[model samples]
Target: MKEYKFLRILDKFEKIYTKIGVDYDKMRLILSMKLTLDSRRTSTIMQDQNKNNNEEDKNIFNRALIIYAIMGIFIGITAMVSFNNMYKFSILFGMFMFLVLTIFISDFSNVLLDIRDKNIIGTKGIDNKTINAAKITHICYYIFLTSLALSWLAIIGSFRQSPLVGIIFILELIVIDVFMIVLTALLYLLVLRVFDGEKVKDIINFAQIALVIIMTISYQFLGRMFDIVDLNIIYKSKIWNLFFPPMWFAAPIYAIEGGHINQIIIALIVLAIIVPIIAIILYIKNTSKFENSLSKLNIAKDNEKEKKRGLFYKIGRNLCFNNEEKAVYDLSTSIIKKEREFKLMTYPSLGFVVIFPLLFILIFSVDSFSEIKNISLHMSLNIYWFIFMVPTILMALQYSKDYKAAWIYQSTFVNDKRNIYKGAYKAVISNLLLPLYLLESIMFIVIFGMKVIPILIIGFIFMLIFIVIQHIISKNKLPFTLKMGEIDKGQNIISTLLGMVILGVAVGVNYFILINTYLLIIYGVILTIITFIMWKKCILDFSTN
Candidate 1:
């Protein structure tokens, strides 16, 4: 009986061991796999960290050392070359270079910070506990502070000889630095929130236009402040006193006055009041409507998509060898397949027209209205031409990309090449050109008033002509391509140069016509005829193959 019980216990123990048996080899393999994955992840993180460190070091060196060195050399060279005017040339050159460098560094650093934040936030499977927004913010704030320090250092190095002037300069630098930082932050946020997707490009362009306007208007103000002009008008009306106030504008004046605390206090008070008021107004306006503005933008995006779909359908049918229904179906499929390409074609075109005006406002301000008017009138005619022409180049790039992705398969189904050309032409005109032209018309009317109607009509006609020319130049190729991120520098240069030549002619015509109604009509008629002829020739050539 004892032997049997012992055997039974042994049997049960064997069964339990079998159920929980470990395959040593398999366990080892699993361990190895986990180790490999962990190692790879660690390696990737280390590599990314190294890359980021390197980039940060490079930017620091470039901004802090390289830029200063370049400015110093440039100033020295200019001073030497100018001989007798060495002091004057050096001062002016130093001022200009420092200003430009400050702007560039500020812009570049902001972009880099954005890219870094995006990368960090986008990292996969990172523990929420490990992420620190405050850390990132601190780092960015320090980087900006460092850049400002470098900028100031450069300024001091440039003008160290004059102690009194240096003191005034340092004070001015402090004021400007604080102002620019606040302004840049506000503007950056405003742009990102206000402009969606590719519309940011339009804002940038508008900022450029604004700069041109501001420069023209500010020239008189600057001249008066510097005492370069003895215009009694500047001293008489106290307009200069109110508008071009001494606090910031009279840096030279302050240097000459030699540390008058009372005057500085008065200026500071005026600035304090003005700055807070502006900031409050901007904050209130932006905060109040930001949400609604974003919603409207989203709606606009949906509308744009619908318009694109409608255009593709219409054009696709025109390009088809078969029945309209079949063509429409084919086109829709093609578009769906190449949605990214379509976006690429559309976004840039929209950006060109929409962003320029906003950018103009930012850079030039309202004070430069006269210069703005002159430049706008001169460039207005070519704006449409550029609007139409640029898409062709962008389309060519897109088409090349699409072709690589096998989008060319759609072409094989078409009975004639002309059908394909016709569809693409129609697609571009309806989807891109018409919307942009409408926007341009609205902008011109707003900026130039009722007098711009004739110019708008003339511009539209020229725009049509340019589109045909672009199609012909591109040899009836679909603007959709599959190549990603490949830029043809040669083609870009050629296209840009050609567009400029056309612009020159438009400007010349505007100059001759001035505000004469009959002259405007005559010019418009002539331009329309020329454009129509060009369109016919180009379209015929494009349709042939």
Candidate 2:
């Protein structure tokens, strides 16, 4: 086994795990070896063939860490709301665990399981118990590191109060982390044991999408919860403690601090100790079954290729386009739908567009519907919606993980490249823009009532104009034909910001100047003419590199 930094630290606890039917040293060695190999594999891809790529990877990681830190700060600041250390610790730890759990679900397969590891290490005489244990250890180390970073200030403050409180805080976090890891592992193993490997793999993919949705939703809701429910509410209604796992740890701390500890807290504390043990037992018993299915995960099902032609294809073919345009539209939609990397990159942004606008409305509103019904409010939100939508979808259309495969576009003997753009435009409109527009329109109607129809119509027209302008500026690449790493991030950000500003001004004008229906019609017609000219320019004169 390689001399892993983690394993070297674990060496001090040799006698502990050895007592529980675990070959502590041997398991550490195997785990260290497997994780080392996996790290090398990831590092190789991240660093790639040059120094610049390595720097870019570092920057991306740093940016990711910064985002995580920002999330932590939000929770930390929320935790500071009450002077009660118990409430502060509970809220911060709970939110941190939630974020960590989200990350675990999103990246667990790649980070811990590494389906490839099953094949690589299967030949080595390692038992399922050892591999599974190593996986738990590997996941724990990283999540703990992240938790430490997230809770540094809170933990330090706890230590200021008393060394025991701080030590308990750290120990409680370890227990919670262990419970979460075991719970997730048990869930994965159970799914594998019950369902086929391919099904489990599909579930994992879908779960990633769900994780993003959940992340945004949880952030918004959890922040709201902290704002609404303070220590008084929590103390009065102990039922809240029963639902939140972090409260289990917090209750014990409260008890230690000479605070009131009730039956609910006592039960939670007991469950906190028992649940992880049960999870570990369940995982160990199912490891062989899990491993068997995992090894066969990559084997393609014969039925996958036989998927029937769906409504998307029918819609694509019948879209009001000439043959060339229809072909581009179909191809573009196909890539967006079928390409995993494209879905990963694009769907999250689409989900964000779906989520963020509503969240912003809720955040700003006194009575949600009453505030939303205000013309200026809805117009501003619509401006933000269209602004974010155009850039995100356009940028998503430009990138593909397998960009080299795009050579087919260059090889084809086509004189008019604009037809390809037209087709791609239709794809963007029908597949991406239309659904989003309908969703926004429906939401507007619901929130503001039937009287909002004219505003929605006006908003849709402006969105169309924005989309056309974006296409003229952005649709130079063949759809899904550029590598993600090669994308101009600054260009996209600038375009998005500029779109927001222009549309924001338009929103203000339409609200203040074109308040009545008659003035709105006049403005809409003028905008329509401008949009038509831009559309013509986009399809006829614009060329992509």
Candidate No. with top lDDT: 2
Q: Rate the local accuracy (lDDT) of all candidates.
A: 0.44, 0.63
lDDT of 2 by residue, 193-220 (tens): 6666445665545555565566455444
RMSD of each: 16.6, 5.0
TM-score versus the correct structure, for each prediction: 0.48, 0.76
**What range of 10 consecutive residues in model 1 has the weakest lDDT sum?**
41-50
Q: Model 1 over residues 454-507: C-alpha lDDT tens digits?
A: 877776666666666555554433334434334444665666667667656766
- What is the lDDT, from 0 to 100, of the residue 148 in candidate 2? 69
In Å, residue 277's CA in model 2 sits off its true spot by 4.5
